[model samples]
Target chain A: MQASEFSRWTEENAVYAVPKTIIRVGQGERSTAIEGAVTEDFLIRTLKDLIEQGR
Target chain B: MSPLSDRDRQTLREMFRDLKYPVHLQLFVEDGNQGSDNAKVLVREVVRVMPDLLRLDVFERSRDSLLAALYGVWEVPTLILCDQKREDSGIRFIGLPSGYEFAALIEALLDVSQNRIRLSEKSLNFIRNVEDDIILDVFVAPT
Candidate 1:
């Protein structure tokens, strides 16, 4: 997929899985890799590179 | 106990209705990781409902340490999405992807199945002109 395609498709729709509720983790009772908008952005940028080159 | 209630299951079923290609959700679990158990059942139900769009590949860390380590998994209950050839898509979860993160699990599959990403033109440009190897990691912590 091209860069633009990668950007558009992933941002529009991103998927992930997690427990029913994220209580707390880490040193200061924080979320460990909380997945949401940040995750969508990450996936949007990351998927194409993986899908295209298998990297 | 089944964590996913009827409503949530229906929600997931609808969310994953339009996946274009098939996606394999690779799970790596070690002993004493209760999160992996919940995640396993959740994913099982999801794939059970959407048999065409998703598949589950499970590996015990002790049994599949080589493959598990390939994905940089040093902890239990790591979830990664794989393409048709079972290549990692760089979308990974260190802990159980539940609660709000459940959406991410579904979309990771959708993105791979469809082979698409949605980003701003600026982000796309950066991804386009990249000439060197780049490692991308996104972290979220409640502060």
Candidate 2:
């Protein structure tokens, strides 16, 4: 989105500032599933941590 | 390098007039990194467009690691959008917000100025009554 354009994720009364992650790093889709390299798996684990803390 | 053109600056100044509150741009920079260096310049230029509504603060971990750690920042060129009191809004750009990310940064500035998050009633009720520290890490890249 352009800075001049309105934000789709933003609302008049509320701002949804959720963290966003890139899907693909390079050409092929070889994410660091087991370890951590700022991929989808890592993000899920981070979300899981939040859920775990809630429990 | 000056990242913003005079025309862009002018346009941004007009856009910033709509800011209802001040938004602080807290930049965590690394000394020797190329991307960090570029991001610093970019952030400075943007902050200049709205001096009344935005302030720029740059920090180095070598001297201010505690502040960075407090924000959960472990990377160079982490641009955090803070509210009037300089509170973290959990809205951050982890790299140089050049290109498309620049729009995100500008929007973030507006969002932070408001210092509000609109949630569903269910979620808002949960957060309003529940007591727990929340940590969210959003990852993005520049192309």
Candidate 3:
């Protein structure tokens, strides 16, 4: 969502920067937030690790 | 007034000149909202530059509840990228894509049009082996 459009959402999520990504797997069972610009490799690794941690 | 400048329009036309497939932009908007209206304007301007490669459909969220639900859109001013056949490409923008986000929107359009994914080999493998429905909410400021 546009953080600028929703003050409440931005405050609740603590979106103090641009490109704050929240990744969720399987109906919100597991989720993680990554701040700043991330590379494709980093994102892929994080996803794999998050899934592994849930196992 | 057009949201895009003449130079920006020319650049977009050039960028999309090599598009091999048509991309559909499905925009879900709320009535009487400034942000939604701005989003509509920007998307319309972008599409106008490359009509041959882009198709746009605007849906009022309140009036098109079923269509919104079908596309899993729960927010106003959300833009979904789809194929020529109206298949979802799993790319979406949940607000007005201004500032830096506009560049991302353009990149997504290009990728969607070509059905291209520039991922690493390992990342590609991970995606291919994925068996779960994933939802990624990338929150961003316009600037």
- Give the top-scoring candidate (DockQ): 3
Each candidate: RMSD: 12.3, 11.0, 2.9
How do all models score by TM-score? 0.64, 0.66, 0.81
lDDT for residue A17 in candidate 3, whole number 0-100: 84
For candidate 1, what is the DockQ?
A: 0.04
TM-score of chain B of each: 0.83, 0.85, 0.89
lDDT string, candidate 1, B25-61, tens digits: 8888876678777777877887887887688988898
Candidate 2, residues B4-122, lDDT tens digits: the string is 88899998988777788988888998888887888888988898787888899999866789998899898777888888887778788877798898887887787778765655565
Output per-candidate TM-scores for chain A, rounded to 2 decimals. Answer: 0.25, 0.33, 0.70
Indicate which candidate wins on lDDT: 3
Error of 3 at B81 (Å): 0.8
- TM match of model 1 to true structure: 0.64
Summarize candidate 1's per-residue lDDT along A1-55 as a digit string, tens digits: 1226434634433324321112122222222233445554654444444434532
Candidate numbers sorted by TM-score from highest down: 3, 2, 1
**The 10-residue segment with the lowest total lDDT in model 3 chain B:** B134-143
Question: What is the Cα-based lDDT of residue B6 in candidate 3?
Answer: 93
Chain A, candidate 3, TM-score of 0.70
Off by over 4 Å in 3: A1-22, A27-37, B137-143
Look at candidate 2 and give me any clashing residue pairs.
Answer: none
DockQ of every candidate structure: 0.04, 0.10, 0.60
